[model samples]
Target: MKRKLWLGAGLSAAASALAGIAAYAAHRLSGPTAALKRETLFAFTPFETGVDWEEVRFNSVDGLQIRAWWLGRPESKRVVIGCHGHRGRKDELLGIGSGLWRAGMNVLIFDFRGRGESDDSICSLAYHEVGDLHGAIKYVEARLPEAQIGVIGYSMGAAVSLLGSADQPAVKAVVADSSFAEMANLVDFALANRRLPPRPLRALADQITAQRYGYRFEAVRPIEALIRYGQRPLLVIHCTGDTVIPVVDAYDLYAAAQGPKELWIVEDMPHCGAYFADRPAYVKRVAEFFERYL
Candidate 1:
């Protein structure tokens, strides 16, 4: 009888431990974000290409200051905006932005709130980020009316580009790299990579994140936006060796894109590391898209 009682006690302890783990995982799924570190692994800049840039700032819909670097002549109406990924700063997009500017288009690369020089208090990942993108469009329009606007986004920014363009009629072109179909799927992918099963845990995470952020993850589907984008020109690129976001995701995005669209598969690249993996080819492809559409 004592042995049986001990066995029951052990099972109860195990159940309690498992429940505790699930709770922790759900909380982590909300994904706390911080500012990018003072340094980066790559050296991407416009100075190397010998172009003078202007400092610029604009306020997001939520009244947060978004900082950016603007290049190209004041009279130019062809503008390209570069959106950085999670925990990213503007300079990280210098390589791509410089290439666009060289191709005779204005370029603006900015920081999202809680990431770089922008507000550092909170980051709702891609949910709150769409507002920042809207503010950028407004800023450019106020300064250069009747301008043709294009956007290139990486990772989280990639998803935001597609989501934001759904409402902005002026967005002429978009290039998205290494974006997940949905935020919840991304959370599940991250957990699975760590050897954690993402079943009930992912559901809990979804609920917790929605309650905290005041929005549902189901509403941030970029794939849905691509279907509705309607002939504005979309270029979706994915790296083959990306473990964080399976390369197969690019196929779905490409297939969903209804209008003039192109999909490029980067060979043996990882995550958002495509541009750095092959700078020349990456720049040429992106520039060609904007050249055709913008």
Candidate 2:
């Protein structure tokens, strides 16, 4: 009986330790990390590309300040919002902004909360970032009431734009690149990459995440958001070589879109590498998409 009691105690302690470790990992994954906060030059910029731009700032619904660059004059009614990927800054979208600027479209590229010059806060991936994107749209609407707005987003930003624009009539079109279908899939992917089993740990992490962050992982489904996004033309782009987000997500998004939609599956490129794969073609295709839909 003594030996059995000791074994039970040891097993309980081990289970507690595992749960604690999972909670810590979940917190780190869902919050801002150094990589997500780091300022890195991963893409060509509007400055280098020679486009007219003005620095701007706006506030999220939760009162977090967001910094952005307006890449064209207010004279044009066509506007596109550029949303960068996870671990990315607004500078990374400047190239795309510059392209759209030349296409006679106003572009707004902003940093999500806890990134670039924005206020420091936890990143709930696409969950909290939806407010930030909505803030950008409000800023643009106030600046140009007659504006026809579209969105171009990469990875997490892609997810954010989809979620933010679902009920927003102001946004008319969306180009989502390398976006995940579900938040749970993302968590599972991370777990699989680490060679960890995703069963109980994933559920435990989700519970801990909701308790700590005030948002459930299941609430961040862009696939479901697309279903609610009515009549907005969608262009779902993903690379075949994207390991971060499966190409099947593109198919799911395309199927979920309620309006006119198009899918572009690029050949053998990494995550969000469609732009770098063929700059001119990518810009032309995306600009034409906004022109047609927006």
Candidate 3:
């Protein structure tokens, strides 16, 4: 009788453990569910720059409808695709997009899959967001074949931009801002940001991630893409005081870049806060970089 009782308890415990793992995995896989709407994404739309803007949509490689805005400046031959940070919507990139527009470039600012007015889904971080960018490039090429194109991305968008540029030859130049070297460190940051302590569930998380995403987090690396980028006028930007993504990643990417590349480190600038620290310098450098390449 005691043996049977022990066996039942063990089975119950095993079932509970499996249940806990599945629950945690689902929550992590689901990611953040909230996102900004179109109006909110463009609250300051038609930016003070007075660029006429129109809402646009593009289908991702996987057929997800991506929400975007076209900031068209009359007779602008260059188009800069502005990619926002993780969990950030299209409107948040208006400042940067406007800067590019003022520099005599048109801007296409869009939301990644899970953020803003984009298709409803969980953020894949950069795993599949790369497809979103590829879709954007195709959309631009198909609609405006005569214009030169470039990409300026923030955080996750930066990583995806680099990855996309590796495959999209039409992307003339790239500006990757505050991007992570690998997705593993990003997972750690995500947990810490939520104040969740690291635990032994890492293996379970990895398994779950692989099962759902069809690739391990370690494989979603941007360094490989940067290495393949080979002397293509790449610009890597990072802030010294960025607590989210360490500055070391920037150094690694700069060292790994085999082509014409520039790395800019801002003192005391937080993550994605390069412009916030010194708007004038940021504007001048970025505009010049694009002008030099695109």
Q: Highest TM-score: which candidate?
A: 2
In TM-score terms, candidate 2 sits at: 0.92
Question: How much does each candidate deviate from the true structure in C-alpha RMSD?
Answer: 2.9, 2.3, 3.7
How far does residue 37 in candidate 3 sit from its true spot (Å)? Answer: 6.8
Clashing pairs in 2: none
Candidate 2 wrong stretches, greater than 4 Å: 1-10, 32-35, 39-45
Candidate 3 all-Cα RMSD: 3.7
Specify the poorest-scoring 10-residue window by lDDT in model 1.
29-38
Please give, for residues 1-294, the per-residue lDDT of candidate 3 as tens digits: 999999999999976775576447535543654632334633666555577789899999999999899988668678899888766788788777887878888889988887777887656667778888988998999878987888999988888888888877788899999998887766666566666543435455666767765667776799988767767888999999998888898998888888789999999988899988888789889999998888
Between prediction 2 and prediction 3, the one with superior TM-score is 2
Report lDDT per candidate.
0.80, 0.87, 0.80
Which of the two, 1 or 2, has more lDDT? 2
- Cα lDDT for residue 189, candidate 3: 64
Q: What is the per-residue lDDT of model 2 for residues 1-294, given as tens digits with 9 covering 90 to 100?
A: 999999999999988976986797677757644446875445445668798888899999899999898888657789999898777889888777888899889999999988888888877778888999999999999999999999999999999989999989999999999999998988888778778777777898898888877788899999999777988899999999988888888998888888999999999999999999999999999999999987
